[model samples]
Every structure is written in C-alpha cells, then in structure tokens.
Target: MTDPITIQWTPKTGLPRRLTFEPLEKGYRRIEREWNGSEWRHCGSEHTTDLTLHPPEDPPTLEELISQIHGTWDHPNPAVLTFTNEDTVAEINGQLRYRSPTQDGWYAVTKTDLESHLRTAGYPTIHRLSETPYNRADFTADSIPRQ
Candidate 1:
C-alpha cells in the first residue's frame, strides 16, 4: 500500500478548509471539514482520486523578531525595535547615556556610547560578544510546556 498523503488546502473564499487524501484500495478518499464559526464541522468525505492536490508549505521553525537599535535624546522614554515573522525573529534594544549631566540633547550617541551602555548592563562591551542562539527552534517548542 502506498503511504497516504495529507494535502493542505486553501479555500476559494473565506477561511481555508482542512482536507486529507487517504489512499484506498481502488482510488483515494478525500476527507474534508468545514469551519462553523467556532469549531470545525464535518463537511464531506468522498473518493476524490481525480482531483489535483496543492499542498501548502510547512510552517516556519521559528518566529524571527527584528529590532532597529536607535538612540534617545530626551530619553525620558525609550523604545525597543522588534520584528517577528513566521520563519524568524530579531530584536535590537538600546540605551542612551550622556558623558556628563551637563551634556545636552544635541549630543548624539556613538559606538562608544553603545559600548559603555553594554558595560553597565554587564555584557562584554569591549568585545561586543553576542550570545544569540544558533538554532531558534530550541527557543520555540523544545523549552517550555503549557501549564
């Protein structure tokens, strides 16, 4: 017997529908379900050996968040830049400190300032070492479980 394949389906309108193609003795059986607003309701189960299948791509391993690091002038309020996609995620957080209390907003932060901030934050400010994960999947599903 051929290994059965589960095909991902996209609806022509509205939300997508879930369907699978299971191999049968004579042909293939297409089992489909419908979304009734709240839960998935059974729609149809039929032999669909003639129909073509278009499977959707697998979901991404990680949700990548990206953030642009920028400096603050007044710095009474600071923001972090972050982005997340289905595939990957990245974040860039920053801190702004003046050389002296007298230093005005006119002074813009430089690489030197970023290093100092990292030092104060207990990171390797001089080497600018990064401990970002090599594999993001470990952070996504392998770590925690639902309570």
Candidate 2:
C-alpha cells in the first residue's frame, strides 16, 4: 500500500483546508480538516474499497529530496546562539560549552536539540535539513561551526 498523503490548500472564501488520504487494510480513508485560525478541526471522513492506488515505482533519490527542500520557501528563521568557554553568552550575527550541571549557565542550542524536543513531545519525525545546500561533512562533528 502507499503511504498517507495530505494535500493542503486555501479556498478563496474560506479558511485553509487539508485532505488526508490514509491507507487502510480494507481500503482507504479520506479525512477532511479545516484550519480554524488556531488548530485543525475535523470536518468529515469517508472510506472506499479502492486498493488500486500505489506509490511511485521508484523511490525518491537523495538529490530529489535535496532539490525539493531547497525549492520550498516557508522555513522559519531560527535564532542562533553562540557559546564561549566563559560564562558570557551572546547571540551570533544571525542567530556550547558543556560544563557541570551547576556550571551550565548557557550552552549553544543545536538543531539536534530542537529536533529531539519535538520528537519527545510526540512528533512523528524531525528531519535535520539545511536551508542551503550542504554536503555530508557539514553534519560531521569536526566540521566548522555554523555562524
């Protein structure tokens, strides 16, 4: 069976709405939800015994994933903090010193930190994707620190 897909769009007269198609054992289920300015509210759902739907024949390549990520334009601008060996902490131009528990006044918050928090809060998956192009070495521990 194919993975669930959700398509979102905003109507000309109403709030934004999204339709999600989830694959089930018997068939598929379609769930409709609308954004009510605060949260998504379920509108309705329908099930059909359609098992002909399938995923793409070929899996998406790494290049395709990277290209799709760069094509998107709605990413948030996160605040980056830089940590020094001393107690003094300051925000970088854009935007850790790991000490004892008591000495830990402020440490740099990495992307891994935010992703871990979201996952712990019941989020399904958190991807460590970069806004700009990057290589494998960019994620290595010995790589240059991002500014």
TM-score of 2: 0.33
> What TM-score does model 1 achieve against the real structure?
0.27
Segments of candidate 2 deviating more than 4 angstroms: 51-147
Candidate 1's clash total is 11
Output the number of the lDDT-best candidate.
2
Per-candidate total of colliding backbone pairs: 11, 1
How much is 49 displaced in model 2, in angstroms?
3.0
Off by over 4 Å in 1: 9-13, 37-39, 50-147
- The true-versus-predicted C-alpha distance at residue 21 of model 1, in Å, is 1.0
Give the per-residue lDDT digits (tens) of candidate 1, residues 48-101: 554445556642222110122233212432222111111111222332222222
**Per-model TM values vs. the true structure:** 0.27, 0.33
- Deviation in Å, model 1, residue 122 alpha carbon: 72
Q: Estimate, for each residue in 1-147, the C-alpha lDDT of model 2 and write its tens digit.
A: 789878899999999999888999877899999999999999999785543447547544433433333422234432111122111112232222111123313344433553453333322111322322322222222322335
